[model samples]
Target chain A: AQSVAQPEDQVNVAEGNPLTVKCTYSVSGNPYLFWYVQYPNRGLQFLLKYITGDNLVKGSYGFEAEFNKSQTSFHLKKPSALVSDSALYFCAVRDLTSGNTPLVFGKGTRLSVIA
Target chain B: EAGVTQFPSHSVIEKGQTVTLRCDPISGHDNLYWYRRVMGKEIKFLLHFVKESKQDESGMPNNRFLAERTGGTYSTLKVQPAELEDSGVYFCASSNEWRTGELFFGEGSRLTVL
Candidate 1:
């Protein structure tokens, strides 16, 4: 079974400051990682995914994540934060063997970007 | 193109009452998935449907919950004798390609089992 763990329940960052939301995954084999964001009263929106490519994966809203194979981590990062960036973020993973399988998600981390 | 849409955006019912939620996937999307979020917890997968077939239902909580995707277009999930623990948001997502696995999601149906 593939699983994702996000240690932080909440993340706070000031405007113009960089922010990081941590996530670690455990999979039987190679994993397909994904990041999603959900705004208030809205559905989870696709941010980005890491299939098998460069360690740095960039996505919408100036967000990026570093995939560390050795550390078994894929931490979401943003060079600068905006008040509008405040939302709930989720990390998910699925084993490479089964692309059709459902993603195993981590407990979401609520991001609060302060102005 | 319209994204995934779920019916009964909010349903509040008493325990033991039956509630059925509906989801209509994006056109041409053959893969439909059901997931649930219990408050602040991670979203948990309930099942997956490939066309009209149940590809995987390993994550379904129990037999009390029944899901059917008839004719591979729209899916429905029926919960009988619901409990307080079942109060949460039920989300439906669809993906046209399995390899890419980028899913478009519905706003979700908020179910309250009182």
Candidate 2:
């Protein structure tokens, strides 16, 4: 079964400092990885996805993720964080081997960007 | 374009009561999906609908849960005699033909069973 693991329960960082949220996955075939953010009283919003090609994929709101195939990791990163960036981040993976399989999500890491 | 919308933002019901959640997918979206996030748990898939037909329902917890999409439009998920364990936030998502995997989610319906 394909699964995504977000090791950190929560990450705290100062505003304007760099931030990283770790994510690792296990899948039988090539993985379709994604990052989503959920704000208070809102639905999950798509941030980025890694389907193929580029190892580094850039996403909305100055976010980027590096897809390390050998490491089985897709870590979300931002050069400079803002207080508004604080939210719950989730890593998800889709099993490419299975036709149109539902995405499996991680437990989610709460990000706190202090001003 | 309007994103996916779910009705009754929050519902509090007693155990063994029936509850029905509604989701309206984006215009012209052929694929709709149902998911839920229980307290202290990761979001889990419940089912997928391709038009009015159910594509995959393997993730549904049990027979007490029933989902339907009539005429390939709006979808509804009904829980008969809900259990306390069923308290969670139910989310609905949709994607069009061009972007099959890129799902747009609704604000979700929060259900509380006591």
Give the CA lDDT, 0 to 100, for residue B16 in model 1: 92
Q: Which ten residues in a row are the worst by lDDT in model 1 chain B?
A: B96-105
Worst 10 residues of 2 chain A by lDDT: A95-104
* Model 2 DockQ vs. reference: 0.68
Overall local distance difference test of candidate 1: 0.93
DockQ of predictions, in order shown: 0.79, 0.68
The Cα RMSD of model 2 versus the native structure comes to 1.1
Highest DockQ model number: 1
Q: How big an interface RMSD has model 2?
A: 2.2
**Model 2, span A23-57: residue lDDT tens:** 99999988989999999999999999999998999
The digit string of per-residue lDDT tens for model 1 on B10-104 reads 99999999999999999999999999999999999999999999999998999889999999999999999798889999999999875566888
Chain A TM-scores, per candidate, are 0.96, 0.98
Off by over 4 Å in 2: B98-100
Tens digit per residue, CA lDDT, model 2, B1-114: 889999889999999999999999999999999999997689999999999999999999999999999999999999998999999999999988423368889999999999
